[model samples]
Target: MIKYIEKLVKKLKTSEKGQGMVEYALIIAFVAAIAIVALNNGLGQAVKDAFTGASNMVTSASNAAGTWATHKDT
Candidate 1:
């Protein structure tokens, strides 16, 4: 049993297989953080443009309705 325990301890001390996996995890976390920040900055402008386009369409429709109502008596 003593020899078995010694072999287990030696195996634990010589392990290096997990070091590369930790490095890859850190790099992927950094890239995801950068992408989130970039998306946050651009999202506001995209929403603003969509609202502006909708407002323009509503105004044009309102004007056309008013013109038809005023000229209908002729």
Candidate 2:
């Protein structure tokens, strides 16, 4: 049993599968960290503000279009 455990440990240490998985996990963790920092530091607010501005513009344009449609040029 000990020999089998040691063999398994050695195999795991020499395996590329585990290395690849660890590399991918590290990459995911790094990207997640970056995203968290970006969203926490005004990036989130900026995005929200942009969306709000766009919505306001669309609302204004729609109201104007409705008014123009109702008040056709004679």
Candidate 3:
């Protein structure tokens, strides 16, 4: 039983079959950790605010242009 267990352990240590899966799992875990940290540190809110600001600016510009067109003949 000891020899069998040792052999199995050695085989698992030497095996490369699951190596790719392990690497992918590690990469996914690292990306998730980074995403969590970034979102938790107000980076997510900063991005949202940036987009909202831009949208508001565009809307204001559009409204101004529409008003100018309407008043062009006056």
What's each prediction's TM-score?
0.45, 0.77, 0.70
TM-score of structure candidate 1 = 0.45
**In model 3, what lDDT does residue 7 have?**
100
| Sliding window of 10 residues with minimal summed lDDT for model 3 | 65-74
- In candidate 3, residue 29 scores what lDDT? 100
For lDDT, the strongest prediction is 3
Model 1 / residue 65 / CA error / Å: 0.4
| lDDT of candidate 2 at residue 52, scale 0 to 100 | 100
Query: Which residues of candidate 2, in runs, are more than 4 Å off?
Result: none
lDDT of each: 0.91, 0.95, 0.98
Task: List the candidates ranked by lDDT, beginning with the highest.
Answer: 3, 2, 1
How much is the lDDT of residue 71 in candidate 2? 92
Local accuracy of candidate 3 as per-residue lDDT tens digits, 7-73 = 9999999999989999999999999999999999999999999999999999999999999999996
Error of 2 at 30 (Å): 1.4
State which candidate has the highest TM-score: 2
Q: Residue 30 of candidate 2: its Cα lDDT?
A: 100
